[model samples]
Target: MTILSNNSQVTYSGTGRRKKSIARVKLTPGSGKLIINGLPGETYLQFSPNYLRISYSPLHILGLSNEYDIYIKTEGGGLTGQANAIRLGIARALCTINPENRTALKSEGFLTRDGRVKERKKYGLRKARKAPQYSKR
Candidate 1:
C-alpha cells in the first residue's frame, strides 16, 4: 500500500489479487462513490448487489462506508474474483489510513489473501483431474 498527499488531500492506494484477477484501488475522502475502470462501479459490476456487497464489505465493517470514494482499476478472472480483489485492496488502503484499522480488518479476515486458483490441466486428462473413460474390451 502507498499513500499520496496532494494539496492536503490524502489518497491511499493498494493492490490486490484473487485467482487470476487483479485490482488497483484508491481511497480518498469523499462521499461514497465507487468507480471502476473509469466507469461507475455499479455499471462495471453489472449492478449485482452481491458484487457490490463483497467490494464494500471492508468499509462497512469499519463503519466508514460513506467516508471515502473508491476508485478501482481491475482486470482478469470474473466478477467474483474481481470483487474479492477489490475488497482486499480497499482493506489494505483503509489500514494505511489508520493503523488501528488493521486489527479490525484482520479479525474479519479481510487482510487474508485468497490463494486458491484453478489447477493446471494435465496432458492426458479431460480436465484438471478428470480422466477419460476406460472400457474393457
Candidate 2:
C-alpha cells in the first residue's frame, strides 16, 4: 500500500505485473462506465472468464466509489495472469482515488504483486533440478 500524491483528473494509471503478462489500468472519477478498447462486457469472455470478472467487478467491492471510468490495457501471458494483473492495476488506481484508503487496500494485499510463477527446467536431461534414470543397483 503505497501512498501517491493526488493528481487532478489526469486519469490515474497503475501497472500490475503477474506471471508473464502486464496490465495497465487507467481510472477516472466519474460514473461507472468501464470501457475496454470500445468493447462491451461480452467481449471480455473471449479472453477469459476469470479475467472478465476481476476487471469488471473491482468497483463493486466495498469502500470503492462506483463513479469512475476504468480502462485496461493488457498484453502477454494467459487468462489467469491477465486477471491478476487487472486486480493489481485496479488496486493501484484505488490509491489514486483516495489516498486515505491506501491502508485498506494494502491490508487486503491488493497492492502487492504476486511474483509466483512456473519454474524453468534446468539443463540435466530431466525436469528442473531433477535427474533421470537413477539406478540403485
Tell me the lDDT of model 1 at 43: 97
Q: TM-score: which candidate is best?
A: 1
Q: Per-residue alpha-carbon lDDT of model 2 for 1-137, expressed as tens digits?
A: 33233764557788888999798888776776666545643475475666666765456564454677677777888767877887888888777767876777787778788999878988875876678988999
Q: Model 1 residue 123 lDDT?
A: 98
Q: Return the number of clashes found in candidate 1.
A: 0
For candidate 1, the per-residue lDDT at 85 reads: 100
Off by over 4 Å in 2: 1-9, 47-49, 56-58, 63-65, 129-137
Candidate 2 lDDT score at position 111: 79
Clashes of each: 0, 2
Across 4-122, the per-residue lDDT of candidate 1 in tens digits comes to: 57667778998889999999999999999999999999999999999999999999999998999999999999999999999999999999989999999999999999999999999
Q: How far off is model 1, as Cα RMSD?
A: 1.2
